[model samples]
Target chain A: MSRQPRASGYFRTSYQADRALVATRLERAMLVLFVVLLLAFPLFASAFLLDLACQVFLASIGALSLMLLTGYAGQISLGHAGLLAAGAYSVGILFREVNAPFWITLPVAALVGALLGLMFGLPSLRLRGLYLAVSTLALHFVVVHAGAEYETRRGYSTGVIIDPPQIAGLAISDPRAWYVILLAAAAGTLLLCLNLLRSRTGRAFGAINTHETVAAALGIDVARGKLLAFVVSSSLTSLAGALFAYYRGFVSVEAFSLFLTIQYAAMIIIGGLGSLLGALLGAFFVTIFPYLIEWALAALPGAQRRASEFFAVNYAAFGAVMILFLVFEPAGLVGIWRRVQSYFLLWPFRHRPLTGARK
Target chain B: MADLELRRLCLRFGGLSVLEDVSFAVNAGELFALIGPNGAGKTSVLNCVSGLYHGEGAILFRDVEIGGYRPHAVARLGIARTFQHGELFAQMSVLDNLLTGRHARIRTNALAEMFGLPGVRREEARHREAVERIIEFVELERYRHAPVAGLAFGTQKIVGFARALALEPTLIMLDEPSAGLNRDEREDLARFILRIKHELGITMIWIEHDMQMVSDLADRIHVLDYGRTLAEGPAAAVLRDERVIAAYLGRAHARPAAGAAGGGAPGGR
Candidate 1:
């Protein structure tokens, strides 16, 4: 029998192109442009903008972790902020008490975070949906409380101080240098996550999310996959925390809280679950939303003095936006962008339909 | 020869007895059919054999005890099964759904997958080829890139069959393969079942409700009533048996009449 020729357009029929990170040449060019813009941001922006960008990078890492666990694996975790706190606190304590170098303490922090994730993930064997969400919520409160109490106990400390270490005779204490380092790390992590999603483990994760019983029937170890997802997600979040601690030169319990968990959840929701580009989009929206709101409010009369209340207003806006997006665009912003792209791609052929849309 | 033997398999759910002293042996290259009335625990039997449920008995896969093993372990031992409800991954494409069936045969490490190693690439290529062949076998080549959730019920069933076939399984278990199918779909499924046994020489254990299809396609039939094997022999002999006629067929045939008018005797046979 003669085999049919493989289709080779924007979409390739071969397995390699089907599983590629960037499917088309246009996507690759777009990615390169994004990188160049990111690299040039620190040079052109002010110190405040640089700091905001750093926060965005940190939040993006956390959002990426959530995307892997919730979006890809179909597992919900409300306690991820707890895992992040665990990592941040472990790094803080190690550097403060043991005098461990920043680079040396980073891996230890990830390990500790992974251990905590394992402990939390154990419940996943018997729990799912709202039950699992509640369990994780409990975990979040417990970790945040423990961190707050620990901080209070340490004498002469409003927050633990962190000293950045020198790497090969180059000091990393400067904010601009740290920003570059954080940017590199976040970008690498994102690439790693993207690569992972195209792999067997990622496929298994997707399979389990779609149908755990079917995945099990296919010889995918569902339990192991769930646990692995939790571990990887926690490790990434912890790495972000460790970097954030060193960059900020302090470790405060206030930084890691349930509100932060909600924010991360919001990021995944707004970006588009299970899409890497969605996570970055979500991070940008969440990080800049408050600033944008503040700026708009400052433009109004008698609003400059109410700047402190912007946090509450920002939260209200976040809630409103989340509800609006959930109602109108359940697939999030990425879904909308995909629809628009497909609409353009199929232009001039009115009846030709895109494949992914379910009838 | 790949054969499966269920040695006095018993399953109890909490206070309810679902399967009791159920024992059977399916030979290699045989189209063995299990016919039962509603709630006769036919699906439970499939679940027990496929390791979805732990039961008190020995399930021998070519003489190796596979009872109480995890589902993935059972699957790795060359046993594959489909669900009664056609459990296709709704969000994944048809090709992905078929690829999942070849998961047991494609052995690649997480590191290999991460870096797109040569081994992973080769295995992925092999899996894709096998999946494509199965898709062609099921006459679903057109829907290869289609999302399965939006397909017609009959097409979804074909996707399920293609997925099970992608494993190159030694013994494939089909759970109610013709549950919601029309006459044409049922005919297509019957032909596929016969093809699996005749052309590929793959052993099959199927649970089907359509008596006509069972009589035509099954080499042998096992009739179950209230968690026990009521009869076992050739399809003609079992279907014509007195006890099976009294318990299952009589009750099934009388359901429409009873629902038409006033209440009748609860145990109407």
Candidate 2:
């Protein structure tokens, strides 16, 4: 979460100290407070707020998956929502066909996602950057078409209706239960991503992204790293989609559109590419933004007249904000957050000399 | 026994030939030097051996054919290489970048590693200890945690050498390891190379246009001029050869850039 690689007075004498995620007492306290707040949230929050929290949790998982692949591995993908759809549709198809339980549906979703990841990753072996992005984009269309065809063939004209997933003979559709489950899922994913990044697997991703020739020369299997990244990221994303399907009790091809894919991409870019905190922050911002816009518009005098084109206004606003972030704050919110923290941390001392700059 | 052998190698781009029938053999525990003028395809020879380039020839290590293998597969057979332009992961810390050199040796399964399981964690500690020793050897402790991208060019080159050393390579190919280093750093590098050869018994292929470093450290010199072997023998014999003096030494003194390739230029890349 700290942007500075080395913070003031953070001397690490051992490897354990160097790798510790929470070093200072302040960080530990902050983490405790954060967890306490999260647990207590559902106790006092409104139903709508609880649902929003669930949505943010779901989006966090997908955003984290995208961050792992694109931010860390440096593999650009535009088929994220397609993978999500695959997961959701797998649950739908499996449940409708064999009366599959939630347990069966979730793993099936992950498996389908892994296979699709393999298919998508094959093209990355021969392409990079924009070309690879385009390849993923094309695959997204194919996946959406498959899901649409399934819906039409199954005679579900509107969309598939997913039953509330049950665990231990109890339904999980209660807002409180859903909130806790989603929170646990999001927390587990964050932990998983943190560990992977600190391991050799994550370093290989960074190496491949920085320089493919160098990565290969250093004995990293470039193709394997790329494919493994896709597999792991897609698996996590599909799992998130399965959770989404269960949360909403619905699965619709129309829901998983190109705009949805763009929104997920926006999450990573707006969050901060390499930082997990950025993904969570970006998810929070994107998920709550439309509501905020609607509220603000309602407060305006011409709200009734503007209601006709609210969707259009939302689309234009999102695009404009994305562009502004890209041009003015390339590092996203994390970068800006760090700069502000540094300013306060180093008050009365404006500039650090080159020798002192590292810490 | 020969540690590595490149036999009748040929590489080209379209109609332009980059390496023409280039053949060389490095012996066990020997520091072999490859010297040539710019665009003489010296780096190409290393590239072909490291599996970065596809050439028409056979490359053998320990009597096993490795010509067409991928770079990682070849590296798994205990060969390591450094780049001329410092092809390092710039955003990563020096320690992280060096640990990457040991990627081939890490055999933990993905599942085990994902959870930071006991086996991989212990393995990581061992590798980290080795990397720390390298950081000490190169005197880069101050920059160990700093990103390689922000380090000075000379320090980055030192990090590059330390990274290759981290591989514990049996056969190390150093492509201009001391390119941008200062006098003190170059001297330290020379000492490191000497210790690596005499103490560790690692075979090395040292490429450089700096004749002094090459002649001082190399057991043998293989000279190239315009993608052709100009001379090959003991350092003293090759240094004295008329053709070597005329083709390489004479031009290097006239124009230094003529000896160092303009990295990633429109040449054989």
Candidate 3:
């Protein structure tokens, strides 16, 4: 056994091999399979499932932005929902009042979101940790209250309605068509984020997060890096919000509540902080969980009527999952997955001496 | 003008005077050592020089008064420093941490970086080459991709030194570079210090407790006691002074045989 090659397929690497994301042909095939499954999801799933998937995609995008700021840059923000609301409301209002095209409205919304994020992030220079968190929380309330008032004062009888645009004379109003658009946007945002992470600015954010004092001593403008993180995070979140508004064809203050902020934070925590893959995984878990509970209740005898109670229970379950993960698995689901992968990868090696009888 | 000068530097923390009337000058290509017992304000002088603390006197670097400047602003003005306890970015890869040292030199604006403009990419590639050179110089190429937190203490110290070197500053201040290193690591650090002075041609102000290492590496030494400079001269002359011996050996141990009795090591306990 020692002389023979084991099934645990660990490959040695050259310099270039070490840098490759997927080290083996098998891993490359697995990635292809994953993409196929993602594309097939909307087709096979029910209407409720399609809606849930859209929510997951939207939340994933928002969480990705938060992960960049909190996980990589080490600056905690509790006002992300406000930024998202800023994007959604701005896009909704712009498209409704000015009759602007989606392409124009989208970039405008993102720019405004980034500006607001920078404004909120300015307080980070004077505060940090819990103090910064509190200041951002205040920002959330202020933005939400201001948004609520703005929506009321605008006096649009139907609120802001986002009609499907005639893109080259083809209307995109169908739910399936909107799903495809959202999926494309999510993929584009993810690719952009991935590229940023590999770039120098991403590394700077990580350095500032880890040790601002050392970063500054090393000639890094710590304050500027932090502000950039906030701006990027806000812009991404706003983009997601704008997509949400278009898909729903409406904008309301209720959609951007503090609970949504908590939900986004929970997604990042459970998926894994700092890891892009974790953001998507977290969004999946959070979005599907309530639907899963509803389905389970319907399946049980005489339990369908108690669906509202189950929804409440599901929220508590989400909070519990977050707390448990923070205490026991701070690396989140991605960390657990890596550990399991490594265990299988190192099988039959008996690296540790046997200290007890086999189970 | 001196490469770096601190004139009558005074620092107060609430009601306590941590540093008072402290003055020093480091010439170009000079290895100046600052020595003192615990709480004698050795690190305070470095903190003031590095702009980590507010001090009453002017800190002139290359004829520019840099007092009241922020740490990053001071660094941009060509002053680089290493913390007393290896303040490395734990989550960052060794190469990334080194690249951060070159941040002040990165002239690209945010818009350019975000857009991945041609000039920004070229400047980034140039900075990466410099960082790689520093990594090789410090013998940390093996751990170039590893996070600083995962590396050994000695390697982290070297990474800290590499980060300081990456700045290519006119003056470098190191606070206790050999604080937690073993004998072999200390010797390795000593060689690097000499290389930094001889090969790099950069002035350094180091606060160190290892007297023998100081005597071997430093061109001149400054002794501090109770926030005041008690002695300053060549390493050989400072080591032979009675007051220097008394400060390190204490008044009880400052006798004729004190040097021979193994009480000569600076910062004993």
Candidate 4:
């Protein structure tokens, strides 16, 4: 249950009230407004903006999953891109070989992701910190190599082409449809994460994250928690990857690179370490950042002459932004958002009194 | 059968023997104090019983041999412990920290919890009620919502104790629960200890350095010096034992000053 006192008029007298996601009338109104805006965005947005929103939604799924594994459960996994690739390939291989339907492929992709997650999580039992990260990195390389091998052996040199997923004879190729589908997936993932975090399983993850021995003494199976974190996070991540494959109509090892893993890691870090909201914000910022850079570069003087150098510039700029966030805003955008919220909440008084009734 | 028993527990860290053939038994609903000087393997015994250390001996809780079991396995058999350093989930609030103690009790699976099904919700509500009662018993209502890292040290220790109590275990192991508390807090802890024994009737194996509190609260006291049992008896008799006195106050104070050697007493080593 949330312990923070609300605005002066609201009071939570019961545990259910305290645990309710939306407590006040103002919050409920804001939520309604937010949902309305999200639903209406596709009707007014251009094709490019719709695609960008879809990408953000897709990235949010991966970022939230990563946040659950690395942020809450305290398991370091650099094999996220590998899990994604496994999901995409499961879809790619199943479709290319058997011409499977979307319904069959998605669950199969999740199962593949779960198996890979189990393999990736095994090292975590014997290792921690940097060593564990290295093991995951090695696994990522192995998965990517296998994907490359499949491409060569199958004679699909460039990549695997996945047909658009069809639901009830309707092809999900339109940007608006993709946007709505991805939005639902992202929202579902967020709700699932919230549910897990508020339950016994989530508390066990938090306790294991804080102290493994203490978690064990409290009757939490630390190894099982770690594996479950990996399996759950990996499955969600794979689902995102599968959606990404369907959205892009391609499954290629080139797209699931180490850089992609780093980008997802950056999303969690620049968003905020442990917060799910931070994951969403980070996904939006990271996905649209390159486009934002391109727009800014286009408006500068002599833009056409330096257009060829834009990729290098993007890389440099991205690194600089990540470093800045790490150095100056360690808590990420959520930290900044909280500061602003508290500033407005306590406008007249700079700080809450040290010895008052529930500051 | 004893609530907890350690048969010839021997623990060695590389070449250093921390606990050597230390045997003890704690009766049901008894407050058993394990006292020792620094590095006397007092904490090690708790670690062994809690399954943190793989000591060579039989650790039986309610006649079930749990010597080689993992910590979670040991806990599944109704054993819980509090660390000396307050190893609480620092980022979580006090209520959440205590709720983790209800992990074993909450039987809902991850899938059920993920969807937040009706059964899961009901189970959670039931556990929350029990945890609230524990918070009230520990007088931690004021700090219930506060993050554990932000609380004062003594309060954090209290939260750790409360977390252990939330397990509703048959046996609770406390490792220096009163180490850093002030006199007033220590007194309150001693009172709580007596209440936990008398009112709750839970068995305890407390490792503490505070002689006065231990003497007042402990039904039986087991003294350890250099990985060996120095004395074991009722609290009053154990405190008056010559060996226990020497272990605490040194050989010079244990005997007449004139007869004691000036240097290289066995207690000095």
- Among these predictions, the greatest DockQ belongs to 4
Q: lDDT per residue, candidate 1, B1-269, as tens digits?
A: 54999989999999899999999999999999998878899999988877889999888999999998999988888888899999888777788788877777878766566566777777877788788788888899888878777789998998998888988899999998987888799888888887788889999999987777778889999998899999999988988888987876565566777434313222233
TM-score of each: 0.91, 0.95, 0.90, 0.95
Report the CAPRI category for model 3: acceptable
Task: Tell me the DockQ of each model, to 2 decimals.
Answer: 0.42, 0.52, 0.31, 0.52
Please, what are the lDDT tens digits per residue for candidate 2 over residues A62-174?
99999999999999999999999999999998988887999999999999999989899889999999999999997689888998999899998788898998788887778
Residues A1-359, candidate 1: write the lDDT tens digits: 00111223545777665656565676789889988998888889899999999999888888998899999898899997887887788878888788898777899988887877787888887899889888878768877788788788876258888877678877687778877888888887787787667566877888889888889988888999899888888888888888878888888888887888889999999999878778988988988998898888888888868878878887898899999989998888787777666566656544435344431
Ranking by lDDT: 4, 2, 1, 3
Give the fraction of reference interface contacts each candidate recovers: 0.54, 0.61, 0.38, 0.71
- Among the numbered candidates, top lDDT falls to 4
If you assessed candidate 1 against the hidden native complex, which CAPRI class would it receive? Answer: acceptable
Q: Which stretches of candidate 3 lie over 4 Å from their true place?
A: A1-30, A154-159, A350-359, B109-122, B249-269
Report the lDDT of model 2 for residue A84. Answer: 95
Models ranked on TM-score: 4, 2, 1, 3
iRMS per model, in Å, is 5.1, 2.8, 9.2, 3.1
Q: Which pairs of residues collide in model 2? A: none
Q: Better model by DockQ, 3 or 4? A: 4
Better of 1 and 3 by lDDT: 1
Sorted by DockQ, highest first, which candidate order results?
4, 2, 1, 3
Q: Provide the TM-score of chain B versus the true chain B for each model in turn.
A: 0.92, 0.91, 0.92, 0.92
lDDT of 4 by residue, A19-114 (tens): 666778888999899989999999999999999999999999999999999989999989989888988888999989999998999999988888
Question: Who is ahead in TM-score, 1 or 3?
Answer: 1
